[model samples]
Target chain A: MVKLNEHDGSIISVQDVNFYYGASKALTDINMSFKKNQVTALIGPSGCGKSTLLRLLNRMNDLIDGTRVEGRVYFEGKNIYDPHVDPVDIRRKIGMVFQKPNPFPKSIFNNIIYGPTLSGAGSRSDLSALVEKSLKQSVLWDEVKDILNQSAMRLSGGQQQRLCIARALAMNPDILLMDEPTSALDPISTAKIEELIDELKKDYTIIIVTHNMQQAARVSDETGFFYLGKLIEYNQTAKIFTKPDLKQTEDYITGRFG
Target chain B: MEGTRHTSSQYEMELQDIKDNLIYLGVLTEKAIASAMDALLQRDTNQARKVIAADSEIDRLDMELEERCIRVLALRQPAAKDLRFITTAIKVNGHLERIGDMAVNIAEKAIILNAEPQLKPYIDLPRMAEIVRNMIRESLDSFVNEDLETAEKVALEEDEVDKLNEQIFRELLTFMLEDTRTITRATIIMQISKNLERVADHAKGVADMVIYLVTGKSVRHQY
Candidate 1:
């Protein structure tokens, strides 16, 4: 197997991760690692297994009946799919954000505090401080501080997406899995989330799955181009954007034969 | 790679337009250098004036090629090889335009030298001019064909032009030293040789950009 990334100190290592939806193979022998505190973007067309690969990182695929994943997904150092390992615990550590803003029908404050509350978090004042810190980290505090009690659904599409990210951060996760986190937002909103991702990578390892090639280039430290359930090429984002070594990767990004 | 056609023919044609304008600019600059050499060798002031007048076309093409490159960068958002090619096109466009200016500089000196007596047969200078013109032609051809061998060949041939330039300078210095009356013509001939040397340098620059476009390895400042 040719490895594009050689990060020795990987936070999450996916080795021969083959996933299947009943008889159909969704991912074929994916071998990659998300390094500590670095943003890795998975880019490809629809049904290319980028999102499936992201879901495999946090074991979100376990919930889907008749779906199976064969191989190891080591988070920190332990294989996440090990019999002794708990998927719920894995989910708590490797938080995920979806394509559309799926904030609960609760208030903005509730959205940030919901994940912490589920895991027997802190006292009333402690939760409030946690909410404030998470909102500030996600860069949504100033816009929504005065309206913390407002329904999260009332916020704009961009703000809702940022709220979703804030909700994920509130879990104090070591890694963040974003599957098309900015696809539903407008350009301005997408730019804000992209900037937030840049800042967030200082402390958290980010593995984003985006269909937007330009956004992947703009935000990720490394980019992996997947085609037909296989990682065609992966390299530094600058190399991927300006001079990809593989012709398939170049053709896809430049829209020659995507 | 050349056989692989872009899905969007308009974008492909826009890229091809940059290449076409670049080659056209190369042709005009090559013509300018040849005309300047012809004007100097035959002592034709009218031919030198024609070389000077024709440089505006290269200048205009330079602007057009740069604008086209910018459009592809802005609108098409070219990636990988296309990105490399457009950047190479813009840099090569500048080199060719500067080469055109150097030809005009040579033409100006040719007009002045034609006013006076011949500068003792003009052996190495015309040879230098011909070598510089071939360098420009080959450098552009290497870029158009994505031919690394021709690009490397252009870089290798530059040393000969430099050697000729030095020989011409040393021979003319002896002419100036022997006869004080010949100093004016000697210096003009020396200036023409210097301009031809500069044209060779610009051709080498184009060759370096082509090498980078093909191999993504910069060979500039290495030679």
Candidate 2:
């Protein structure tokens, strides 16, 4: 329900962002800002730079060899791309959930505490409370309350996705980057994850990349329409889906083009 | 923006069919208004009865178009311009169906007036009917083409129809005062003119919806 002009509370801003995979450019002069306590969905075709733009938020592109980025990505008041800024520290503050439900081979309780334990977050009693709170926030606690010691891989596909979300939640990040987080799950899980995304936005800024247009319309406060490595249009979700001014945005939303 | 077709040819064709049928329904209602007026002018009870019988077809088209809009909302999940057009179509469809009923109302009064001796010669009454009938046609034309200019023209003509309706009422009041026998027929003539005036209002409603369809901003009460 936030207006387009009310984004002065932006938590992260990407200014003049460009990405290249060795010789070929992937994203071209992209500019966007992620407001606090809101979900921004990036939607387009498979190679539209939507996913590439998402990974740039927390410097996930740093792991790739031939990928190079040229832009200033500001998180809070500081630029995360500064040479002194640690990518690992930046990633810890900006957690991510992948397309597949990639829980560790450990037990459910261990999966939830993997990140916090490495950071030496708390004592035994504190870790127990954090696990319960994170699982509850992800809406997976009731289903797995009695079986916290069970292996995460043994859970259903939907349950595993929720577990991955809980693992990210345990880190207590300011933002959560999700890359097609529900693409591998069935309809029931997708709905539950969507509900959680709505709830999660109350505390964290969420940036999601997805192929499903309806999901983008349903969960996002703002949406960016990407095409061929260009950010064609970015606006509030209601305006983008109801009365887009641009012809390309209308054509894409109305199923006029592939 | 013209002839910018959808990527999915089937979806584009389906949307076009819905729009075409909406205009077709508009045409049918315009014919109803003209026939009902003709029946009154010629004092032909058979023509009035035919207009009454054709009301069922208008009702049928209204239902079919509603179902098509609901189907598009559910299946196509349309967005942007298509979304505005579908919503506008539903509102305009309601206005046209109500206009058809108003025509029937006029026909029922026409049937009663035909049973009695003719009152004073109907001069402004037929003129009012012609203006209202043209309003219906123009409103539908604006909706089909998403023409803002035609929609604005239709909105402006509604004021003229209202003035004519008032003039007809003042002229009929003299007939009721002069003779008691003429009072009955004069009242019915007044009701027929009132129905024609209402038809103009419904046409204006269709025009307002067309403006909304073309430019997502509403112009309902501003005019």
Candidate 3:
């Protein structure tokens, strides 16, 4: 059993972590730390294990049979992978938004309250207040406040994604994990989400995986470059985009990579 | 390690074009300074006039290079080293153009001095021009090869040119005090020396930008 040491300024720390899918190894001895209230972007070409690493943060990989994670992933001084710890409780504290908007078939109001309601958040008045607060935090309050009862499927792709973000925020998690949250949306919508990311970071630590390099540069405070399941470089976003220390990082960001 | 081409060949070509044009501009300014000094030494007004006439070409190339840099910045949206390279190229282009203008300043002064009787056999001014020309060449070479040593050498050469400028100034001051008749020609020669010194400063400026491009750290105004 790993000791439950007190965490430093970082909210999450991954130490000597290796992940495997069946017999195929995915991530290798990865080490990183995420600070509180910062937007950290993970970027690279596809199949770099950036998405795998994001899912691993909240124990999202535990749902898949034969997928195994080795080493310690400490959240708030506790190793989340310990057998005694609950995976459901770890996930509740680290909510995720997917690449595509996946609102439930139900109305927007119910979508926000689904997780809290399952945990037995009773009373009609309490659920309604939670819905309004989450929607406003995701910057969707003005557009959808009047149409709270409407089906989520009617919203645009960008709105639907923000609605998903609101749904994630409904749990009042300390950390938000986003996997390519803006890739499916149009430019204007992408801009809005990027702006929301800038605003949300004041209250939440955001870790985003993005294929779009400009979006990573625009939205992230720090950036980590991943390649072939290995972490290449992690640095301040300005440093990563302007003058990375490693040649491999420079090659990838400058579009000179093989 | 030395030459990794951009995956976008067009981007590779765009960067190459900026580099080639900068060297061409460097060569033009070098020739202008050489011809203008030769015209003064040999008292040849025609060569001075030719140097003066070549100024328009330098101006045109400077504008063209700036436009290309801006286009690359907007269209390609380059990052990391490519971003540093483009920004450096823009600055180097401006320095080279200013060097060309200084060459023109030297040519105009040469025409004035050539009209008068020989100014003290034109010894130090020609040496200064030669050193300034070499500074321009080495600075641009440093940029093309991304060679830090060559850039540092250019900066040291700039110091040498400055020393030569001061020596020439003191020597000409004595000539002016000895005879009132030599004042006009000696003043023009002094103006030419000052212009050559400024040209060396501009070359040093190019070398400084090259340093920033290669290291991605600004060394400007620090020395």
Q: Please write out the lDDT profile of model 2 over residues B75-178, one tens digit for every residue.
A: 98888888998898899889989888988988898899899888878899999988999999999888877899999999899999999999999988988888
Spell out the clash pairs found in candidate 1.
Answer: none
TM-score of predicted structure 1 = 0.97
- Which candidate gets the maximum TM-score versus the true structure? 1
Q: Is candidate 2 or candidate 3 better by DockQ?
A: 3
Global Cα lDDT for candidate 1: 0.89
lDDT of 2 by residue, A80-180 (tens): 89999999998998999999999999999999999999998889899999999999999999999999999999999999999999999999988999999
TM-score of chain B of 3: 0.96
Task: Rate residue B13 of model 1 by lDDT.
Answer: 90
**Model 1 fnat?**
0.68
Model 2: per-residue Cα lDDT at residue A103: 92
lDDT of 3 by residue, B146-181 (tens): 999999888888888999999999999999999988
Error of 3 at A98 (Å): 0.8
Give candidate 1 misplaced runs (Cα > 4 Å). A1-7
Candidate 2 chain A has its poorest 10 consecutive residues by lDDT at A1-10
